[model samples]
Target: MISYSKIRTIAAEKKLMDIVIEKDYVLDWILWGISENDYLKYNLVFKGGTALHKMYFSDWRFSEDLDFTCIKPINVDKLREALILICKDVNNKSGMKIELKSIEASGDTKEDWSYEIKVEYLGPRQQSGGNLPTIILHITYYEPILYEPVKRTILKSYEDIPGDFFILTYPLEEIFAEKLRTVLYQRCYPKDVYDLWRLTKEVGD
Candidate 1:
């Protein structure tokens, strides 16, 4: 049982309100489309470096680009089209230009899973410190190759504001695993190492 006030304090201490808000809006748009289409059979998850697992247990400072996973297999083209249409509609009403980046689809033979749909936002780019591009959106599908796709809902560590339900993301454990792999494969950043260390300590218990 994670306390909301603890999460709120960490967010405030790290000045992560803006990033959290942006992530919320982007996810809300995706969820709205899925819900409207009666695609609730699919489960959505928010994962990656941006979702700080360490913060689940104790306060820590970290940052991440948006990454998500959809457990239902989907028509990649249709999903992209739907996302574009939703972005356009939202922009029209809110005057926020949310552009979709190119979509990427791939499969995981080892895990017996396939994924489709990669949504990216091209508008209102946010820069962190001096270099990192603040990615606004990402969506991916995960399905087991041998079995029917399973519906798994993992709540994210963030406040849910009205009209922005997408902000509620996947579990910190998933994010921690992805981040650990990222650090192992790529030239690791200090923050990534730090985040991994802190997250491991928290989840280890």
Candidate 2:
């Protein structure tokens, strides 16, 4: 966990909301927790908008939730256990209070699972009377890996206390493909358009 003052200073420097800065720090700690969890380390491959920011490009938009594709189908009970333990480990190491509040299954089955893990934080922002913010983990099980998952280091912005940790994530090519899918088949989100354009600029048309 980053110091309250340090977090505030960052928010000021970036001209962003204080809570956003706090959430970013909490995100790092939570990912650090996942890094230490052996099951989550290999099973969950990080992806989506947050992955774009954390693994691929800086100057990308800040992301609110964590999206991961579980390589194998896992039951709710086992998933809950791993996540609860992760929150505990993070609290112990970072002195930041957090919990796996609930795991909600929107759709999907035991064979192909999708869960939303809400991690509520009693972080520095709580001092400012903001509601306890949650970091949502969108975990989808029984997903095929389109490309070879690569190990990537977290791109941290807050003050550094802990060292390096790596997680498996989609390569830039896979990310572009997925983002393009969203833009074409889904709602054509503004972020998708922006991301696709950025990717084109980075790797060429």
Candidate 3:
């Protein structure tokens, strides 16, 4: 398995360690709150951007968001409220103006299945500090093929080394599928296209 220290060193070399460390602290805070409040069982699936893909042997461009998956259905409103309060509390403690933005449920999506939340800093572009220029948090739950709720399951994989790592990521095949769908249905980002190629090669190997 790739050593966590190695990952941290790589991030530090890339000037991303500060952001990484800050995000980890914030994530732990959220986890603690969720556990204390009996929110739901969840595991931190993803952390540092490149570290995520690195765990899967895929080449991914840098990203500034923290992605998580809930192992059970969460009360959307309650979760949002709690996150907002936590953000405020953290801001008060740190003197950093962090903003929590809730994306309304829409577009033929079923409730109690999956949703997204974003937490960002409010300031001038250059004024934003951390490894994350903009902090985007993604929270998704399990949904079956028929849009039915299902028990959230952890996705596990072995790192390139000889150890196991729980990867909070879609399967490489599914990722490719989504990439294709995005190219067909939305304006494609060049980096995304590059990522698809990189992932494809890695999976093939």
Candidate 4:
């Protein structure tokens, strides 16, 4: 685990210390450790806001959850067990407490099988409240690939947070396409609009 001081020093050097919070730095490390393990063990591909944050260097929005898409069919029960083990391993390594609350699997075909995992995090970084913060990971297995996935190397300057690593994710154009689709066909989120605008400025359609 990277020390908080190290994260701060790096952030200060990058001129992002004022924007990225400490808790988020910790969460980003935890997310990286989990993602690294998942890619090694299950070959899961990262996606959504988290992917965008990595793909777009100037995009500084912090993601609250992790999202991924499975490349092929796998046993749901086994996948759940692997995920629980991953949470346990990350907690042990990072000194963060994480527990898997539940894993709900739905959808008939492999192309649409969705695995929604509810995870509880009991860490000092979070505010003391009635309930602890839950890390939600939405996984869809065998989703039709809209574009080819590529390995993205997240440089430290991009986020000024810990846990920079290489992750396989859909291309920027695909992410842009999905963002537009969400605005048009799905629930509208202000962040989506902002992301769409940012993508337009960064990469043209």
TM-score of 4: 0.76
Where's the lowest-lDDT run of ten residues in candidate 2?
Answer: 124-133
lDDT of 3 by residue, 1-205 (tens): 2344654565576576554534443443333333333343333333223333443443345444555555555666777777777666655544445677555442344434555666665321224345433455666554222222222222222122222323344455545555666577875788667766776676574
**Ten contiguous residues with the weakest lDDT in model 3:** 153-162
Across 29-132, the per-residue lDDT of candidate 1 in tens digits comes to 44444434434324545455554431133244543344556665556676666667765765554444556665655565423333434454422333325533
Could you tell which candidate, 1 or 3, scores higher by lDDT?
1
Candidate 2 TM-score to native: 0.92
For model 4, the local distance difference test gives: 0.67
Lowest lDDT 10-mer window, candidate 4?
A: 155-164
Runs off by more than 4 Å, candidate 1: 1-41, 53-64, 106-168, 184-187
| Sliding window of 10 residues with minimal summed lDDT for model 1 | 143-152
* Candidate 2 residue-pair clash tally: 0
Encode model 2's per-residue lDDT on 1-205: one tens digit a residue: 6677887898898898888988878888888889998878998899888888887776788888999988877668888898899999988888889988899886655666688889998886556465677899999875567899999988766555366789899888778887888788877878779888888787565
Better of 1 and 4 by lDDT: 4
Any runs in candidate 4 off by more than 4 Å, and if so which?
Answer: 1-23, 38-42, 126-129, 155-164
Once fitted onto the true fold, the runs of candidate 3 whose alpha carbons sit more than 4 angstroms away are 1-12, 15-54, 57-59, 66-74, 81-103, 108-116, 121-133, 139-167
lDDT winner: 2
Off by over 4 Å in 2: 108-112, 128-130
If ranked by TM-score, best first, what sequence of candidates would result?
A: 2, 4, 1, 3
State every prediction's TM-score relative to the real structure.
0.52, 0.92, 0.49, 0.76
Clashes of 4: 0
